[model samples]
Target: MSRHRTIFRRPILLCVDFDETITVHDTTSLLFQLSSSSASTQQQLVTQYVDEVGEFIGSYETKWRQRELISSRSRTFDDAGLHEFLEGYAAVDLRSVQRVVECRALEGIRHQDLVKVASSVQVRSNYAETLALADDWKIISVNWNKKLVESVITQAGVVHEPTQIIANDMKADQQGVTTGEINVKVQSPMDKARWIDNVRSMYAATKPTVVYVGDSATDLLALLAADVGIWIAAANTAASSAKLLHQLVENYGIDLHPLMNCGSVGGRIHNDRPVLYTVTDWAQVQSILKSPF
Candidate 1:
């Protein structure tokens, strides 16, 4: 007797987040630190603000409420005021900034092992093959820095088409490069979600199978909107908001973080919704696609 396979007819819309999800380092933060003259000081200030905001957001029962409050205040807080608040209240680590910068600067530095461990990274495990397998696929690497998206596309050896990219800045040009553009400065998480929703609606068709892969809590709203949601685990430290979101998902009987070290895979159904799978290797992902769970 042969078992029947559920074939996915709709185009697999892969909406991937840039930061820690695709790139080994957070390119937006990297660019911010690199662009800043007072890199060390600025990094500390930013980190502090992030921590404080994260803590505050995590304290709330509904994360969306916290996001709304932040968005409202962000409009009032000028760049300088935001910087000051971060420095005073958040207490960021300068080392993290320096490390990110160093990692970004290193040429030919591929986190092959990490890439091998997590199938989420854009370049790893024969991305071209996966792209070819899908009937139709579009990769949206969302981030505040557009340059990072360009850099990743260049490094991945994939054709960079402007219609394929969505980012915040136009400070840098992808001239003579094939890459799509959706210029919108993503100052806050809400901005990110809004852009994602806009993109989804713009490309709306008959029950499009949208998949969103992200590594931070900022991506939670967009992920929730997607037909399939993938949460990529960050190295070392877990972003506070993301951890809280994971806990909330767990409360609903979903195991967001399944793999312990790496090279493990597990998934579970939540509320009779889409199957949430934790993948640690690109090879496993390929295998899954070849013969889906």
Candidate 2:
């Protein structure tokens, strides 16, 4: 059982990340691998590009640039050309590694081991507990893969209308070919902040307390914007590398010590505004919410 607080009359706007946050593995990569046999090779190239450029080259601009660059050697931007361009740049072929990760993740969920472990630590089951908590709050998933998040929530027994899921819109042409490659037009950090602002303004009369729960640095902007920021680290791994990198660049100071620090477990308040808490299990999240604010 969980406890509820009455002082907070404002509805909480709960935002979550999709990849590695809710699901154990990135679903998009899984879909790509399952979609085609050459998916592995394509994914490898993309990974290399992202690693070298520090940005996903799934946009029209990137594609155009790649096409132009390869035009001298190849006449068309076919699969091979694309692969070659990608191979010249990405870090790792995430698609190749997704299967093993997804399998392990599904096993954990199917055996109820994750839930059991979470319960042991006093954290409620993520899907169930979150569903229960949604009764009073507006829960939205800010993820790169909106459809995948929708599927997860639906599978969890929660009915979320299409409009409720916020993400970058992907459209394909009539030829059944993706007009533009899969790209995150609105990034997680930007979207989280934008959504929070929108919710705050829309419900200004009620002045609801906004809370954002996430496992990566992509959620940092939203976390900072929210009344509460909850960081979940089930394996004691910090998932804020992107944010840390941005911070380092902005500060122009490179002392790897702070970035490498994993810090302690469990959630706690920070900066007097948004409460910062970390949990190894979701049950701890439930317990925290159950505790008096």
Candidate 3:
């Protein structure tokens, strides 16, 4: 599982997306459940909305509806319409969502409980191997929450630096309850790509090859930009987080959020980039990393 070998003769920079990519469930679901079992705390997120926040979330839901038009059963996402989708999707206000999550979803949640979820949540198969690969190469996690990602990786015994994680954050109070000042970084595919570009610039002298691993359509931009993009098609599997996500959305009678778009099965979309490799098992990832392709 150790990525001692790579296709590039130069150094390798491995970028992994968090959420369903590595974890069995969306990290938000795990974190959202950490709050107290009070009725208000357990209420639907939309129910907690207010003024501009409500409007922002409503606009975000429009993106969700657009994804609905794509059909949950379809696995292949055509990039032909992807540009238009991203243009409309650019309207999503991530800071608003971050604020909502911090103020509402994490209201009654204690910092200790948040840390505890790092161990309680399920880690995908070959996670140790993934971490091992990171140990031997430049690895960074791009996710929505910085603190949550750091805790999960740290608790898993991976010694990744805080800076290695490009994500958003919400501070906590003295009583171990989460508080204000949301610092968001990786909210969209462009943001994720920007981090990769920054890293690429930093390692310009070494001319490192960037390899990105992600599990959903949200990683499309980063995937397209990478020298090698590996898509983890674990969504429709028996233990797929995407299945649960589909079910959750169904219960609410809504379409999958555009950001949560689980692209088609094991196939390449033939985008501007040569192609993207899709894998259901970690072994496939190991195989790809071991070969020149």
Candidate 4:
């Protein structure tokens, strides 16, 4: 399943989104589970997260309708507009992180505690199999703690370790207790795109082909930045994450093409008309990446 750089003329760089993309469930709740807070306190934190996100979505929907009405006369997919639209989500995302800090939800949690919660996180079906095809693997996420992402992947029996993880760090004391202050780095879709470019730069000499697989709105920018973008709508979460993705695609008229065969990978960014391949499961991803596409 390994790729030979000499024969391929370039390496394969697989960048996957964490949370609902790789895992069966988003790890946001798992982060809270690390804290020894009473069940009621933990529920309060989770409820806050849900309320804020819901409010943001409500506002976003209003704006979405206005845009739809504005474009009713002539409708064509505006790739650049879609990029701008998703970038605006950064503020809401950052606000959520700030609220978590203010509430001290993660404070007092130890690193080892995170490892315990990570063990319960489940990887999507066939994800590890598809991951083995890459010359290098990286997890790009907006999740508050990087260690949780690493631990989850390690526990999932993934033999190929992630070369890099682009995510926020949880500040911890010498005694390993979380300070509740996140050293925020990745928060926006733009941030994800920037980090992916940083990773791609490391392989400038090889000119590796970059493939990004993601599931939510936060992953939109990074998906477009790669040579091949895969939107895996998890069966369990399709009603929410998948619906949001579909709404964005529909509202903006995105050029989403169904991936039918193995040789569907693009060579470079299709700026003129960006195309994102859609998939329902990791087995499809494995089939697509079994050979060069």
Candidate 5:
């Protein structure tokens, strides 16, 4: 459970990324494997979706790199058209793969198996254990499958409203296979921020503060859009959130501690940079939120 330092007087909306921010491994990848397809074939499809399609989901590369590649194809291409093409291609690929997986349905995987997968995979410590306490935190799944993300978190016994999770998904059968047409909601990183803004407008009267947490560059736009943006760098990895923020701060020439509401919030702002916070795990994040200690 997240340690409570002090009670919040205003509504707090946590806009979080689902892929690697909460779960240790990518649940989308795991969902693809459950249709009884061979491991190699599953990996091939996932690889194509990430590499040839979504620019590895903006992990090793940036969104600008994706635009550069697109611009190379046709300098005169329309921006809106390119965006649509990329998103459409991913949706088609994902649906096509789901169809193929359903055709096989030889795994005999039951819904119970999803719980096992959730347990087998190492979560970020108490991250899943502290969900309900987050109130209206939304899981912005940038990946292709929402059901898979929901399944893992649901199996964790973290009860949350349906509106809290935004992602793509397909209906599942008794065999634990995707048996319906895919529903694509969020296709790009920009969509994450856009959705949050939309949600904010819905609860505008409350004047909630949006706190976005994510792990990859795919979450760049949303993180920057929030009142408080957090980067959850992989543990012991060189791509620590602090390092990434340092780079962004240097590149954008922005200060850490902005002039407005500077010291009233939780966590410390080093040398007056951005109102950014970096924690090794979810527990620390909860700790930082409750108090400035």
Candidate 6:
């Protein structure tokens, strides 16, 4: 039995990331692991994904540092700069998806295969306990397959199943087998942020308190848009583990506060600079949710 309750005056909309934030492992990578491709091809697909993403990060950092040196000042992470940087990632994401399709890595997987994979990927502790605190819960992700995400949530027995799942779709053949072609919808950080805005607009009349929880750069923009943004990380990891995230926040002039320190929405929106809360686990999240907001 879980203590399920909400203390907010207005309606609450909780948006969460589906990857490492909710699941114990990244299910997208697991999709390749479960591919019907030969062992060697599977290894190659995994390696290619890592290499390309690594190269992109390395190149971006090098270019950014060079520009900083030439300018003699750190770049301010304003709206325009942030949007440009995030939107530019759409191409990188598309290339990765295209590679998966061209190689036919996930071509033969079926819904049952996804369900089996979802069983192996565990949700964080107290996830359901915390879900009870929200009026509506939705998952906003850049994951390639929506069914895979739904499988994970259904297995977790969340208090409230997501009213909607905003993600990409996989093209299936006449026989219902994956065709290796993915329709890219939420492809970048910018896309995730826009979806958050779209959700907020739906509840504009009630002015719902929106809380976004996530674990990576893809979740950054959406987290910023929420009334309460929580960054969940490994309990043993140091602050330096999120160097890129810290750099972006510091440069952009956003303030990071401990989740336990946050009380009401008033404190979060008191200034021009946005406030993002950090937590190591869901227990900390439960504490805030248990209180009246």
TM-scores of all models? Answer: 0.57, 0.56, 0.68, 0.86, 0.65, 0.84
lDDT of 3 by residue, 69-165 (tens): 8764324444444544444444344544654555555555566676777887677888657646532333344444576777777777778666677
State the displacement of the C-alpha of residue 78, model 5, in Å, after optimal TM-score superposition. 21
Which candidate number has the best TM-score?
A: 4
The pairs that clash in candidate 6 are none
Per-residue lDDT for 135-186 in model 2, tens only? 2344444343444455565556666667656665333445443332343444
Q: Give the per-residue lDDT of model 4 (tens digit) for 245-289.
A: 777776766567767653656533343456788788888877656
Q: Residue 7 error for model 4, in Å?
A: 6.9
Task: Judging by lDDT against the true structure, name the best candidate.
Answer: 4
The per-prediction CA RMSD against the true structure, in angstroms, equals: 11.0, 14.0, 8.4, 4.3, 8.3, 5.1
- Rank order (by TM-score, best first): 4, 6, 3, 5, 1, 2
Worst 10 residues of 1 by lDDT: 105-114
- Tens-digit per-residue lDDT, 1-293, candidate 5: 88968744666677888877887766665655555557776666556544544443343236445655655322232335334433554464556556445554324344555556666555676776445445468888766556556677776777777888888765567655555345567766567778878888977988877778887645766766777777676765555334443444333323343223344555423333434545557765574355421
lDDT for position 206 in model 1: 51
Q: lDDT score, residue 268, model 4? A: 36
* lDDT at position 43, candidate 3: 52
Which residue ranges in model 2 land beyond 4 Å of their true spot? 1-8, 34-37, 53-124, 135-144, 173-185, 236-275, 291-293
- Sort by lDDT, top down from the best: 4, 6, 5, 3, 1, 2
TM-score of 6: 0.84
How does model 3 fare in lDDT?
A: 0.58
Global fold similarity of model 4 (TM-score): 0.86
